[model samples]
Target: MKVEGGCHCGLVRFEAEVADGPVEVLACGCSICAMTGFQHVIVPQSAFRIVEGRRETTTYRFGSGSARHIFCTQCGVKSFLTPRGRPDAMSLNLRCLDEGHGLDVTNVAVDQV
Candidate 1:
């Protein structure tokens, strides 16, 4: 299934190809993710694309500086990021996805580390 999403201010937009069936989201207990209320839908780098506003986005890195947290400069919303654990994959914020994407979130596993 192809899903489209963007930041709250609509500056950064993206598209990703996800599994067609039920999807499993991750709710991380890490300080940043917890504070931002980010729900993750991990996808391979090949399956994701930045459709717009690439120049309008900013990157932030911390704690080992492996993960590249990409956010919209205008809204400060982290729509997607390159996770430290999966450097080759993209971790998209489920809450940022546009409605009617038809994603069935079957499970939300809490990951605290």
Candidate 2:
């Protein structure tokens, strides 16, 4: 399935191909993710693409500095990340997606919850 999303201000847009059912959505308890209420699913970098607004995005790293948190500079929304694990994957925020994407969000496990 192809999923689309962006920041609250619409300054950052992206599209990704993901498995259609029984997806793994994580509820990260790390400092930044905890503070931001960021729940997500990790996907391979090749499965995801920035459709627009690259100029409006910025990266933030901390601690071990492996995770690349990409946020919209315009709205300060942390929309996605180059996950520390498995290096080739990205963690995209589900809440940022366009509506009617047919995601069964409520059925997934919340890792840190």
Q: What is the lDDT of residue 109 in candidate 1?
A: 57
In model 2, the Cα lDDT at residue 37 comes to: 79
Clashes in model 2: which pairs?
none
TM-score of model 2 relative to the true fold? 0.90
- Top candidate on lDDT is 1
Candidate 2 differs from the real structure by a C-alpha RMSD in angstroms, to one decimal, of 2.1
Error of 2 at 4 (Å): 0.2
Worst 10 residues of 1 by lDDT: 104-113
| 15-90: candidate 1 lDDT, tens digit per residue | 9999888898888887899998888999999999999999999999998888899989999999999988888899
* Highest TM-score model number: 1
Off by over 4 Å in 2: 106-113
lDDT of 2 by residue, 1-113 (tens): 99999899997899999887767778877778878878877788999999999988899988888888898998899888887665798888988878988876643544342
